[model samples]
Target: MKLSPRMQFLVRNGLKGFLWLTVLLAAYFLFREVVITHKPDAWVERFYARPMIIYLIYCFSEFFFGLIPPELFMIWAINKGDTWHYLFNLSLFAGISYLMGYINFLIGGFFYKNETFTNLKRRLLKDSASQVKKYGIFLIIVAALTPLPWSGVSLLVGSAGYPSKRFLKYALFRLLRFAVYGYIVYQTHQI
Candidate 1:
């Protein structure tokens, strides 16, 4: 009558999944009812229609600073409805994110040249580069897939002088993260 350890873990996870599914269904029904009773405003349509504005905001937010959470944009894409438009927006966001990571990689090289910090924290500087060389790529993918600061990971890889071609090849894993997140957000919100 007792479950094995693996079975226990599976049962616990199944229960969690059931709970989440129930909540999501309830939310979906509520969302449908609200949409039926109250239409979205005209400005809402206008804003979503303008892809350029959204792309600009995404680029600036991602590149200059990781200021805005990308989920907001994903949700926006879901609300936009047309499949092509949503896909376009999501792809644009992912591309910009990748480019920003590359830029951060280059910016990291600057730390090596900055004599002020090097003088103050020689050991710290040397150790960081060594650590990156040792474990940067795996850590980079993990950071990209999660909510962690992927920009910092990119910088570390660059600082370690990891080859640009290798970084590009491996860092494409970020696209997978985008695809998975986009699917979940879109599915949950879609009618």
Candidate 2:
């Protein structure tokens, strides 16, 4: 017997769902084992507990954005405590990162309005324009996922006069990327 296209699509998605569930379960077991066997690092907790240090790290890291992978901070947060703290750190990092990206977008807009910077912007972002056109918002999500310089992409898209609403809408995926990557890193990172 043959299945309809819709049925085939559903079956494929169902299988994918099951596979993900299995992988997640295995990861949970591994994480639990690690937590049980390893003692939490006192210095890591001390460093994480310092609000001034965390603020400095957040500012500097956000300034460096793509240059400095945010995973280091994410790992630090995961080491801070349990799942709730990990999730809080994910949201914190994502919010700060998104704010920086928005600031970069505003800077891009400023460059767009200036003739000298506008020419330079065109030269630098010429290729990205085509890529953005081809892939639309998915390109932004891909950049975010790969831990690439999403601020750069944000700047380029903003300078190109991509609709502000659409840019904001698509950029929200940065939060999801942070959450997903934070979870994986939390589960796998040795305490």
Candidate 3:
């Protein structure tokens, strides 16, 4: 079967968009060393030991996204003290993750919008943006729950200037993943 001229144009445009998105994702990993590494200071470690501050610190850590497994943070929170402590940990993480995601949202919206990847980015986000629009929340939850390199996706969406309401909706879905995983950690602690 042969594609008409119009079909060809669409195919070419879609291919260009796919390639650009791949490159954008790859580029994020290329700088993963700088982009993903987090070294907690001695003071921070000491601070977590205080029991009262563990929940607050764990939330802040999620803002880094790919820096570490969220399970580790959950485990730390579960280790705190009582049911109130667990709820506190959940709240802390939620606040931090939301704020952290916003930073990436802005980074996508602003910092990476250079001539370096201009055409490709425009093609991917602009042309293929609809593909995500339908299942945005599902995707965000998956990204938050799994160990995938989802921060890049968040950044791309942000860069493309996806509406803030859409972004928050997705972030809330992702937060559920974190909370579910935290529950898992808490259960494992009992046995």
Winning model by lDDT: 1
Once fitted onto the true fold, the runs of candidate 1 whose alpha carbons sit more than 4 angstroms away are 1-50, 113-123
- Which sequence of candidate numbers ranks them by TM-score, best first? 1, 2, 3
Q: Give the clashing residue pairs of candidate 3, or none.
A: 108-159
lDDT of 1: 0.71
Ranked by TM-score, the better of candidates 1 and 2 is 1
Q: Model 1, 65-169: lDDT tens per residue?
A: 456657668878878778787888789788888989888877766754567655644666657666666666665666566545567677767766677787888
Q: Which segments of model 3 are wrong by more than 4 Å?
A: 1-61, 112-138
Q: Write the per-residue lDDT of candidate 2 for residues 1-191, one digit (tens) a residue.
A: 99865555445554654465466557656865687347556455667679568757776767565655676677677777788878887888899888887787777677668899768857776786565555546555655555556788777766666667777788887888787877778778756
lDDT for 160 in candidate 3 is 58
- Candidate 1's TM-score: 0.69
Per-residue alpha-carbon lDDT of candidate 3 for residues 1-191, written as tens digits (9 for 90 to 100): 99865555445554654465466546645544463335435434665568646544554455555565555566556655677777777667656766777677777777446665567766655665564554445445555545543466677566655777778776776577667767766777763
After TM-score superposition, the amount by which residue 46's alpha carbon in candidate 1 deviates from its true location, in angstroms, is: 8.2
Worst ten-residue run, lDDT, model 2? 9-18
Candidate 3 RMSD to the correct structure: 10.4
Ranking of predictions according to lDDT = 1, 2, 3
- Error (Å) of candidate 1 at residue 117 is 5.8
Candidate 3, poorest ten consecutive residues by summed lDDT: 35-44
